[model samples]
Target: MDLLTARIDLDAIAHNTRVLKQRAGDARLMCVVKADAYNHGAQRVVPVMDASGADAFGVATLAEGASISELTAKPVAAWLWVPGQEIPPGVELGVPTLDHLSWLIDARVNAPLHIKVDTGMHRSGLRESDWEAAFRMAARAGLEVKGLMSHLAVADDPANPYTDAQADAFRRAVALARQVGLEVPVNHLANSPALLSRPDLAFDQVRAGVGLYGLEPIAGGGSDLRPAMSWVARVLAVKPLSVGEAVSYGLTWAAPDNGFVAVVTAGYADGVARSWQGCLDVAIGAHRYPQVGRVCMDQFIVWLGDNDAGVAIGDEAVIFGAGGVGATELADRVGTINYEIVCAPTGRTVRTYTGGTGA
Candidate 1:
């Protein structure tokens, strides 16, 4: 069996959901479970959401939305699209452009729809100039536009004015839609960062992704969100290393005279990034062990610091968890976002979930 494992704390997910719901206040919470709950395994996370009283869910594709729909009867919306795609029944679709809107209108898809407005993100969405025409056409075509939504370009930073500007633009788009006689049942513009930083923008619903997993969307900040996923592995060997002995691919790391090197059953293929070498450390029981040398494709070595560090071959090594070495710390070590760090592990790595009403 693969020694590498990812432990998901279902209770932590539920706690984060409750925290997010509180932050949302009067606005409904739409848990964004895209990318398999940021690689935390949505099959397990979505159920936790169902029990947590989430109003709905938002995903990147129809497949994700459909999968979530199977888990719960709550509303599920898919935002991404192909030129011609089949949106499953009872699933809401996000219209990216006016042309796409026309296609849905022509098809007479009676399913609920959320309109994406470009606002200031300049990414994907219907332009402000086309919102009136799109809304008018949708009304004429008898399409059900349930929500008006937009993405936050840079809300992670509490000081960034771009998010504020985007919020304003989104409001204007919604106003134009109303003026054109389109009934927008809900107006949503807050992602995780915006939801936490700007409670005022949590109009009708808040799309929270990373925050639900206990990883902060903002850098070096945000509320008390606990990380729900923990990457772990078993120590396969514990060997003595002389002060001058080199290790791994580049032989870049040398043992400190009294220290020993530990072999862990995980590497780049298991979602432990290669860049983690020399920087990241793992928790051996309650102690910390520093990773040495280059992380290999199948395994990596850790420095026990001393000969009697009390670690053994069968001991568990926590790469990151709610305690000890955490996801936020791991992300910083690799100069990447916490989202990418938590999502790094692969299917080859087994996932074991704990806590919540059900496993």
Candidate 2:
């Protein structure tokens, strides 16, 4: 079997969820397991989340919501809706616009639904101009209005005033719903950053997205999160390169000194993005080594310096996770966010889960 794997610490996830819940105080925790729990494998994340007291699970699509609802008894809500996607039997849906409500009414969608308000983000939500029509139409159709939700544009930045403004607007929108005779039970506008920084925004529940997976949504928030996913592969071969010798593909990187190279059976095809070639480092146990040469589709070369490198075939090379190259560091080096780094590894790599209620 391929040695490349993404070992997940479900315990860390549970810990993070608990911490987030603690931060939220009285608000229920909505573990956003969308994008396959940001590619941490929702198949493994959902059950453990329930064990950790997650009030609900948030997914991005109807299919994802349906998949998880079949696995756990907790409520699963799909926030983004396309016109024809099948709304699963009990899965809550995020109703964004009058058109979405129209489709829900036409399809006879008889599940819990939250109204998305476009208070300030101008994203997918009911507009201020369309709120009355949406509320009235939904009421006319007897659609149960379970909650009122809005997406924040700058909740991640503590210095941004938009969070306050958005929260106020969200409240105003909810008040408008009340005026229209709709009882909006759950009022949620907080994502991870908002939950960690602005507890006032956590009305009924907070959608803890990347934060639950131990990747911080805010710059300093990672200090509280334990990285849940680790990427690793085993060394396939070790060899020495002469001072002037070039390395893999187009000779992009060459041996500056006499260095030993360990070829690991993991590369872009395995979710190690090609852009990581000249920039990323992998860990052998706790020792870090620079990756040389252009990363291949199936393998990459790590330059272990001199004889002290002491690496051999069959040794594990950790790409990122505990005691290894962390996802946050890799994200900074790659000029992207940690969300992509953790979600990078696909199912092509083996997933070994550890540390949780299941443990």
Best by lDDT: 1
Model 1 scores worst on lDDT over the 10 consecutive residues at: 322-331
Per residue, candidate 2 scores C-alpha lDDT tens digits across 34-99 of 888888888888888788778988888888999989878888889887868876788999988788
lDDT of 2: 0.85
**lDDT of candidate 1 over 1-359, digit per residue (tens):** 44888889999999999999999999999999989888988899998987896899999999898898998889999999865788798889998998789888777778898999998878889988888888899888878889899998888887988878888898898888888788797879999998888999999999998999998788776588888998888999998887889899888888768678889988888888787887778888878888999999988999887846589988888888844687888878888888888888884689888998776
- The whole-model C-alpha lDDT of candidate 1 against the native structure comes to 0.87
Clash pairs (backbone) in predicted model 2: 11-355
How good is model 2 by TM-score? 0.96
Instruction: Give stretches of model 2 more than 4 Å off.
Output: none
lDDT of 1 at 346: 87
